[model samples]
Structures are given as structure tokens and as C-alpha cells.
Target: MKKSLELLEFLGEPVSRDMKETLAHGSRQFRMSVHMTRVPSINNVVLYSHWHEELELLFLAKGSALFHIGQEKVTVRSGEVVFIPPNLLHSASRLDQEEIVFYAVLVHFNFLSSLENDQIQQQYILPIFMQNRRYPKLITREMDEELHIYPLLEEIRDAYQQESLGYELLVKAKLLEILYRLQKCAIHADADLDIGESRNSNSLQAKKVLAYVQQNYGKRITLADMAQHVNLSPAYFCRFMKKQFDLSPMDFLNEYRIAEAISLMETTDKKMTEIAELTGFCNVNRFTETFKNFYGCTPAYYRKAIRNHAGDGQHAVRCDTDLKSY
Candidate 1:
């Protein structure tokens, strides 16, 4: 917890919540990126929910979290890794007073394929990306005794940070190594999983909440509107959201909106006021205050710093050690 809080304080706050489903984690060529996500327990802040097309591995280095993955709550403790398949709604936060820190690595499967189809590709790789087999949901420290993939994940983090020439080659090789271990893990652990179980109605409602926010985030949405979309009374809806995400409906919406605003600031030359309106904030002042509240700094300064570090391939600015895997 000391190291986790230090990293959070180093960055002033967690990396601007990239809660959009469509944002690519890294460049298209590499299609792999790592984010040191730290979720503070204060201010009611949590990692907001979103889905993407890239496979995700979250190595929980310190503290534990009650993770909302695909409508179910999973308690991931220290030294465990979370394997989230593409297109699953997932979010995380500290279950108690402690802060949570983890490394989120996203990689598109196509980038990892061989130049030509091979037997290894067919037998070991194709089933995962093609959805024929489900990815394992969790990898515990105890289960990794034989595989040692946790240490490999730490190696991946070190290799990615080196940035030496041809380091991508090492990263790719390690990712494939992890995949092989994951295959073995599936046979051992997920064999008893009920793949065809019916999803809860609450999960369906959660999906609806995500869908509504994604489509309507740029509009003036309210608590009543959010509750109505899920067809629950305002009071019940708030409780449902709290139980599921530990956040109010408007807080979730605001996190989503702020994520969008950060995207716009990075990708566009839009003015602050325009970006505010584009992100569904009623006024620029409100947008600025909320942005500052989330990140302890003004939007203008954040944008200026971003521009200052342009073309360096930074998703967010940090020192190399700030991205510790364990």
C-alpha cells in the first residue's frame, strides 16, 4: 500500500480514466500498451466500466479489489492476475479503505499471430481469439507455481520499459509464452466452468446502463434519465448502482464524460469551451472544476503538458518505475 499510494501521489491522480470502449490502448502496429492504473478509495473514485476489442491482463501487484467483471463481482487479492476477454464490461476499486494498484496490459490478438498459419497457431492460438474457447477469468498466485507466468508478466513489464531496439520482439515472445501458460491453465482450472449459464437480469441491466451512457454521454443526462433508461425507480436505481459499482449514477456518467474530454484534448485542437460542450458539460467552468477535481490540475495545463510531450508515444506521462508490475 505504501508503494501504491506513492505512485498515485507521483502522478497526482490515476491516469485519466480511459473508460471508452473504442480507444486503442497503443499504436496499431504494436497493438500493445501498459497502464499503471491506481484507484484511490477517496472521493468515491473507482475505475469506471468499459469494454474493448483487445485482450486484457491486469496484474494486481498490491492490495485487493472487488472487481466488477461481466456483471459478477470478483475479489482479486494481491499477487493475482485478472484475465478479461475482449468485449467484457470490467471495472475495479478498493473494497475497503486501502488504495488499489495494478498494471493493465492490452494487446490485440492479430498483432500476435504468425506471418503464416501454422500448427501452433491452429492448436494453441486460434481458439482464443475466435471465441471458440473462453479465456480464464482469474490466475491466482498459488496456481502459478508450475507456470511462473506471474514472473513472466513482471518480465514483460521490464522489457516494455527498456525501450531498447528490437524490444518488441522480446515483448511478443513473452506474450506468446504467457498465452501458452494460459492454455495450460484453461485445461486445469476452467474445465468445470459452466459456459452456458444464464446471465443475471442485473447483469443485463448493467449492460443497458453502459450502452445508454456510451450513446448519450454527450447529451445533458440526469439521474432521473439514467434510472428511467433501466426502468427502475430513482431510489432503487441508486442502490443498484452502488451495489454494483460503489458509485452513483451521475458519478459514473461524469467519469465517462471526463474520459471523453481527455480523448478530445489529446486528439483534437478544439478549444476548452467547445470540448466542454462536446463532452456534455453544461459550461466550461463546470468542466474545468470537474476535471481539476479528478486530476488535481487544470485542463489547460494538462493539455499543454500533453502537447509538450507529443510524438513521444506516451498515453500518459510518468517515470519508468511508476509502471511497476509487482
Candidate 2:
């Protein structure tokens, strides 16, 4: 069963002040807490999706992770870093190892709002967010080879740890360096890729449509109804989604429903009937049937299995669609 949109919204709120403070005391400034994580098995990294209004960067320092960024899923190896846009849905998990070590930086846009020069606004933000430019929006091209910036990342970490004499200024300087480096590489590398002709229009549309679905998942959404949200014809939306994700709109909705159901099952004790209705499914019987079909087990069994293994650590799961757990 899926959680109601209202409940999902509540669950997605940012970390509590107390929790944030707990993470802030150490060398890591909780601007966004940085962690070094290791899991005996990656299964604990259960697949779930959620979007945040803050930008996040994940750098694989010593292991590999399978990451789903929008409609694409790929393995990111050590030395590679991925930058995620604010409000984009993504999920990831380690592919192997008794443990994997990586560095993560979560940057709230407001933290850098003062640095938003006219040039940045003109070139990056407007074209992608406002004009809806249908492109990958590269942040770090040839990321596998960009090890020189590792020093800047380390500096940010150290400045937070030391907090001695103008540390805040130093941190900001390092952040600016990181951003400038990414922007410079993106511009040059994308030029070589010549993204004009080969860009995936359908995937771009799918992203927009998925955002709409997530915002309205608790409501009665249909194919024709969602198509109107993107101003694309119903038939076109259906065809485009199928080509882009290999699933029809309805199939995607079902996957989303199941994903939400999994989140609720793990986090709440709502009854199956209630979850079914909240997720937009009409009956528990139908919900169970669909859940079984997709996961090869009943929801109850799945929940119990997860409970038994909940303490192992955070392991990412296969992202059914883009909607993720916050």
C-alpha cells in the first residue's frame, strides 16, 4: 500500500534541528553533513527515491555505486563524481564490498545565492530551468579524470574542521572554485559531444511529467490528465514515455505506487487497505496482486523481511521510477 500524498509530503521534510546539530559538531560542518559509509552488503541500501530542493554531489573515492539519475542508470566508479540538480529524483547504492567509502556534499542553493553572478544566471540556470532546455546539463565532464579538484573538496572539509581564522571565507572560496571548475568543464566537454542533434527530447518530457505525477500522486491521475500537465497530447505522451522508459504511463504509475507502498511499509504501520487507497489503488486485493507481480512477494512478507534486516545500514535499492524516499 502507498502512503497518502499528505503523509509523503510530511515525511519528506528536512532533518530535525537536533539531528542536524548532532552531525554538525564533528569536523564536518553540517552545511550538509558529510559521511563515510560502509555496508557489509549493499542490500540495505534499498531502492527508494526522493527529491530535495538542495543540490548534492557524490564523489566515489574508494568504491563503485550504481546510480539512477533521472531516466538513466549507470555504475559510477571510484574517482568519478556526480552532481545532482535541485529537485531531481535520484537513488544509488554500492555495487559491492564489505564497505564503500565516498564523499558527499549537499549544498543549499540559498547558501550560494549571493554568488549568483549575472553570467551564471544568463548561461546555466535560465537555459535549463526556465527555458526548459532539453539537455543533460553536464556539471563535470570527463569526471573520471578530474582529480585535481580533489584538493578543493579536501580544503572545504578541513576548513570546516579547523574553523580557525577566516575558515568560513576559505570554505566559500573553495566552493566557488568547485562550481567554477564544473561550469568550465561542462561547457567545453558538451561542445565536443555536440548534444544538439542527439538530445533525448522524450526523456526531458518524461522528467517534467514525472514531477507532475509525484506532486499529484494521491489524486486521481490518468494518462490524458497528466498529458495536459506537460502540454503534450495524450497519445504523444504515451508513445514518448514508452520509447523513453520502456513502460507506458500506467505502468510507471504502478511502479510509483509500489515504491510509495514500500516506503510506507518501512516507515509506518498503516493498514494495507488504507495504504492501498492512499496510493490510488482501489482495493487491497488488487494492490497485493500487483505488488506480488512486481516484487515477487506479498507486501506483508516484504515488509517483514526488510524489518529483519533494517539495522545493517543504508543500502540503495533499484529505483522503479524517479520518485524516491526523502
TM-score for each prediction? 0.61, 0.61
List model 1 lDDT by residue over 95-141, tens digit each. Answer: 66465668877788777777889987777676666545665677877
Model 1 reaches what TM-score against the true structure?
0.61
lDDT of 2 by residue, 1-326 (tens): 22212111212212222111112212223244333333334233422344555566666666676776555666776766666665555656556654555555666544555454677655654433322333333223254255356667756655654556796677667776776665544433344344433434544565676667666666778898878877889898888776555568887778778767766876799998888888988789989998987767888887777666665543332211111112
**TM-score of model 2 relative to the true fold?**
0.61
* lDDT, model 2, position 249: 88
Worst 10 residues of 2 by lDDT: 317-326
Q: What are the runs in model 2 whose C-alpha is more than 4 Å off?
A: 1-55, 61-74, 85-103, 108-146, 154-165, 180-184, 188-208, 242-247, 310-326
The count of residue-pair clashes in candidate 2 stands at 9
lDDT of 2 at 122: 56
Enumerate residue pairs that collide in model 1: none
Error of 1 at 267 (Å): 19
Off by over 4 Å in 1: 1-19, 41-44, 187-208, 214-326
